[model samples]
Target: MSESETTSLEAVDIVRILELLPHRYPFLLVDRIRDIDSDRSCIGIKNVTFNEPQFTGHFPTRPIFPGVLLLEGMAQTAGAICVLASLAKSKKPEQVYFMTIDKAKFRKPVIPGDTVEFHMTKLNQRRNMWWYRGEAKVDGAVVAEAELAAMLVLE
Candidate 1:
């Protein structure tokens, strides 16, 4: 929909994230956003499960959520903020896309049944480009964090 139409508590679903982000299954990370303060901040969620593609190679019997993927989820969450921030700046949220990642750090292993919460906040938005800071937490403990960049296109 529109940036003005989105909100917190019940934010974007996987389908909505797919519509807003340039990612998909086997790659798409965030399952949903618990909160989205359009252009400001948002919290994304991912329920780690053994069925995920990464589990196939990330230790077959004992699967753990890949750290990079965790950062990716945070980036995607950051992307959502970037998307909304760009829309606020350019007036069209649909054109935004994630472009870069920086300062990514992973603290612990995330395994099956764990619910990762990705919290992202917009650091800046200059025209089509947006920058954000993100963090991933489980059980209220910091699991990962990063700084990410994204752009908005007219397509």
Candidate 2:
């Protein structure tokens, strides 16, 4: 794709994200999605905050965003784009179920006030299932990564 084409792609905001994903507050890790290339790739953003509920129990004096949530963010990012792609085809699924997580690793701790980006790239797709490789980054540095697979269940 040309640079211009990439730049022209519109971002998916929180409102549309809410419509695409079933996760609610505290669980909804992705705040915004951008640089979408159909179901091929996209970047999901999550702004970490000090007042979030997990901070109180995750740690009292020191709070760090859970690594598990980072993985979930990656899955959500991939799943949302999958749903968006299906919607474009006029086939809406009843639910997107997370099927698997593999090769997950945490390289750094994500703390309050950090804006994490989940960069997801499609690895494969078959029938109603899709697989993606995701890297979680903070300040352009990789903090975590994983391979996630999900299935779209139609009604």
Candidate 3:
């Protein structure tokens, strides 16, 4: 691959994600992020467990990971990379806001013990706004997909 075509793969653990994002426990959906190619793409990992708070009432009899959280995971995954990319340029944003979700679809129910990978690819970017297409996959099969948009707010 040529120099411009070569992309460095980076991984961000929970600690750094915490610094880049405002989400906390019970809200921080992404456990780790990997294969980060600047702000263009990345894969965020979420390990579903039976002990998560949502399972307590989402469905007492047959617990299932809520689909809305899956979409949030995708947005968080994309938002993280955008912040990371901005930091590389010495620009820090105060907050990253989820702007829109489109073409969202849930293909399967995610349950405990499932390790989900939210694969996100940038679709468009302008100024401080970014649009991404994300796919949440388990065992390499897509469980959910959506197109998400986010805007970075500066101080």
The local lDDT score (0 to 100) that residue 59 gets in candidate 3 is: 94
Which ten residues in a row are the worst by lDDT in model 3?
Answer: 1-10
Between the candidate structures 1 and 2, which one is better when assessed by lDDT? Answer: 2
Each candidate: what lDDT? 0.77, 0.92, 0.92
Q: On residues 14-106, what C-alpha lDDT tens digit does candidate 2 reach at each position?
A: 999999989999799999999998888999999999999999999888899999999999999999988887776668899999999999999
For model 2 the TM-score comes to 0.94
lDDT (10s digit) by residue, model 1, range 78-142: 77656655554455555556588888888988998899998888788776777888889999999
Choose 1 or 3, whichever is better by lDDT.
Answer: 3
Ranking by TM-score: 3, 2, 1
TM-score of each: 0.85, 0.94, 0.94
Model 3 spans > 4 angstroms off? 1-9
Give candidate 1's TM-score: 0.85
The whole-model C-alpha lDDT of candidate 1 against the native structure comes to 0.77
Candidate 1 deviant stretches above 4 angstroms: 1-10, 85-96
Q: On TM-score, who's better, 1 or 2? A: 2
